[model samples]
Target: MFEPEKMKSKGLKLERMANRLSNAIEKANHNYEIEFEAANKYL
Candidate 1:
């Protein structure tokens, strides 16, 4: 799902931006998982 070369060829700034976006997405996924776990507690 990740294309580092495609990101690199775009631009250094783009590459960094992509990396930051990936981190943000991962954080979001973690938050979602935690929320799901909390919700499941009463289920």
Candidate 2:
């Protein structure tokens, strides 16, 4: 049986995980940008 409640719960869990992954990626990108800017200043 395909249960609507189970599907919804699974969807919510996936969404939460995706959000965390994206946040981590954003932080990494921010750090990379800062390092790039500093390197650029030295050039």
The candidate scoring highest on lDDT is 2
- RMSD for each of the candidates: 9.9, 4.8
Candidate 2 per-residue lDDT, tens place, 1-43, comes to: 8999999999999999999999999998888433465577668
TM-score of 1: 0.48
Instruction: List residue ranges in candidate 2 displaced over 4 A.
Output: 33-43
Q: Which window of ten consecutive residues has the lowest lDDT sum in model 2?
A: 32-41
With candidate 1 superimposed using the best TM-score fit, by how many Å does residue 26's alpha carbon deviate from the native?
Answer: 0.3
- Identify the leading candidate in terms of TM-score: 2
TM-score of each: 0.48, 0.69
